[model samples]
Target: MTSIGGAEMVDWNLAVATATRLVRPGPEVGRDEARAIVAELREHARSAEEHVRGYTRMFGEDADGAAAPHDTPVLVVDRPGWVRANVAGFRAVLTPLLEKMQERRSALPGGAVLGAVGGKVTGVELGMLLSFLATRVLGQYETFAPPSFDLPAGTSAGRLLLVAPNIVHVERELDVDPHDFRLWVCLHEETHRTQFTAVPWLRDHLESEIHAFLAETDVDPSTLLERLHEAGQSMTGGRASGEDGEGSAAESRSLVEVVQTPAQREILGRLTAVMSLLEGHADYVMDGVGPEVVPSVGEIREKFQQRRAKGAGRLDQALRRLLGLDAKLRQYRDGERFVRHVVDRVGMAGFNRVWTSPNTLPTKVEIAKPADWIARVHGDAGN
Candidate 1:
């Protein structure tokens, strides 16, 4: 093991070891080979180091009160043990659905589904699947250009921070039939990736809103100061009262809780809407694409929905506590319903055309009023 700045150097071997422990074997490769592949993946990591530094410089802290460029650390965890474990868990839940997708793809009339039919086990394959799905969903939007998925680890995989670009990180946990479930996962991630890629402005928009929210974070410094002052006064008065008790010391301890400002709430509401739209689009695409190919598509879809609903409990709570936002499953449902209504009324072309401009996209109001959106779409078509 090498050391950089007292941190143990994470080479390909260590990366391989970490991955083997985290991921179970899929159809594509075995445990030993997985490690070897991860070893090869280290080369990419070295090249990505410069870019990682660049990202850090932009997103990292700087003196002189000047903001960094990116302000986010792009970590290439050759051994992201926890993330790999989570990926594996997600794979276990998604396996049955993936198998169904493969069977369904085999039965398709033509080669409409090309790349997706194969089981996805490698990083490149995963990237390809995501790219393909993104292209399919947001391909029509002129401004919606898919980002290069094959960039070195530190580089952006679209807008997502690539914690593990190689299979070494999360491959073992992935236990689905490569042909089916991997396709589904690819679709889910790519749905998000494509939205950001196609609508370039959306990435900046979301980040700006989040920054605005954070900037206005109303953590009352004065409250803490006041508490300290009170504690000081109590300590001085304690000599006169002869009440310097044990519980008195505990009472002096104070904590400051950060409350969300109005700006944060407004920004969070918009973010919720965007997230809902993204999830909704993925659900709709999965439904539209899977039924024709996968026999158990509906079952897989239901299972996924149930899994998401269950997972949302923790996610919703965490978001509300940390960011003052709720990850609304209902919002996703409503957004899906809205998109589906548009598709039903005007067809895929019309529904997809909505991405042509930022203005054409639905507002938070339109998410609730699917019928109104439908009427508007129909009315526009009539014009």
Candidate 2:
């Protein structure tokens, strides 16, 4: 990979190439079949956006202060294309942090060569991770446009990305109605778009939290690798693998230790709460749209969940645990419960006040106990 300005931190091209190489070829669906699938998806894309936004309007406030723009064109891609796109997205997100880490590395011995090796390792690991993840993510609502993501010309700032092959795979495997499942997936992804666009502050808010997280931490390459290893186990109760270095010690520390400082806790806690809300709200809205809109809603929820819980090979399971994907799996249940509980006690209108300001967002404890959040926000009875 070529270095930029002689100080490249992530070697993004290497990451993309690595991911593309590692990605397994999909089942041999024919070109005509594939083309038909894309055509149908593309046709539904516009209506999916309208239906999703329409439902979102019924449930939450406009996040962007204006009508959420409809200009973000939907693009369909194969699994490898999805991997490259996400590698691009992660580059945009991770570059700043990598640069900060690079600055900290300048003080160490064996700077340039060490940095090159570090960049290579990081790029490879990132590629490996994205290759695995690309198959898993159904759709993504990309809020910020990074030039490197190479989004198509004339598309809007906010866009929805769909993995066409994955969509086809899931529909056939689940034996669910293809049209219904495709629309269902679109509804969920579009809700994500509406959430960020509705609350215009959300994108910047998440970016700022990321920036703070980067500023507060410093790590060498080996330690950073070790930490990524630990993040995989974080969802479970396993200890992160590490030895005596300061960064290693941080990795070895439990989630509590990592969030020990007020500043770190504030940042992590806010991120957790916000993600939970966004996810939960989207799940809630997806369901709220109901059986009328998606007749297989109940079945899709049930078998799709079973599909989610289906075990993989031993190594894949290990990777999922290490990735903290188990924790991500939990967010759906936890977030939806919080949203359901809140709306149950106060009704949707009162719950809408949560969007009024960041202060009203549920804390981790509050998510577990809706009555407490209700009382705090509305002086209703405490849990």
Candidate 3:
């Protein structure tokens, strides 16, 4: 099958097949019940956007001052469908970087031979990773999905995906009101859709940051091997102790952290800050819009937070740590605090200034210290 690097760097089809094969099945219900669940999720997804827009007061307008209608597509998909959409997104975004890496790999002696085998191996690894994630993600707003002819005229290509089975599974697990829980999930996902669609530059800005990060790749075989070794050590709890003599922090570094160069780390920091803002803002909006509409919102929030903290078994927890999912969990808490603080101090209008331009976006430090972001973005006006 065709791929970013002619199947030399990754076999996209193999990855999808592998993920679909390995992903655990979602919770089961009768055919009629399943149909009902999907229908309910779609209904909630459509209406959730109105609630999100009403609360956040954001319209899907471009930064160029060109007003566009909000017609972003919404798909209520099962686990395998979620996997396919994400694989497509990954392939699209990683295409340029993979092509560049392929060029570098081809220059090395015996590189062509290594690539043929490496492609299959990498594809399998990616599939395994996606399989793990496929079941966990309840919904997502795909920021980098390629342009589609199916989208309406003047509509952004971004698509919102709701993993119907997982949502049902979580609601069952949490034993919360199915209707309340479903709407709650949509509120968060729709907020993301609004964030990207409202601030048109956001999607492109994030894509550029990702491309910039990928462009800094060290494709040398030896460097790649070293990163693998570092990752192994990280996974095995082998990092050397720091001055504190505990080495806890070093041991806790994810595979994502072990593989990065200093340059990539700087970019990662910036990306992290941006993600923190997005996730936090969504979380804030969900809760902010919750009490008024979702009667069981308080219970859902309490139980969901507990579930996130509880996590899974030892192996799963270890994988989560290595995959940087733990860092992601922190992003929710930190980002929400940042948004809440800024909104509490300066109001939503002041917080909206962040979307004015990339320049107004918070730096990594400013995310942790909202006062600084307020001071910098709003100057004396914020005070």
- Which prediction has the highest lDDT against the true structure? 3
| Residue range 146-176, candidate 1, lDDT tens digits | 2223333443323322223333222333332
lDDT of each: 0.42, 0.70, 0.81
Candidate 2 Cα outliers beyond 4 Å, as residue runs:
1-7, 58-69, 148-157, 227-262, 380-383
Q: Which has the better TM-score: candidate 2, or candidate 3?
A: 3
How far does residue 248 in candidate 3 sit from its true spot (Å)? Answer: 7.9
Ranking by lDDT: 3, 2, 1
Model 2's alpha-carbon lDDT is 0.70
Clashes of each: 19, 7, 0
Clashes of 2: 7
Backbone clash pairs for candidate 2 read: 62-198, 63-198, 63-199, 64-197, 64-198, 232-322, 232-323
In candidate 3, which residue pairs clash? Answer: none
In model 1, which regions exceed 4 Å deviation? 1-178, 221-258, 292-295, 310-328, 375-383
Give the better candidate number (1 or 2) by lDDT: 2
Q: Which ten residues in a row have the lowest lDDT in candidate 3?
A: 234-243
lDDT of 2 by residue, 36-128 (tens): 888877776666666766665533446776444565657788888887767767676766666666766666777677677767766776777
Give me the overall lDDT of model 3. 0.81
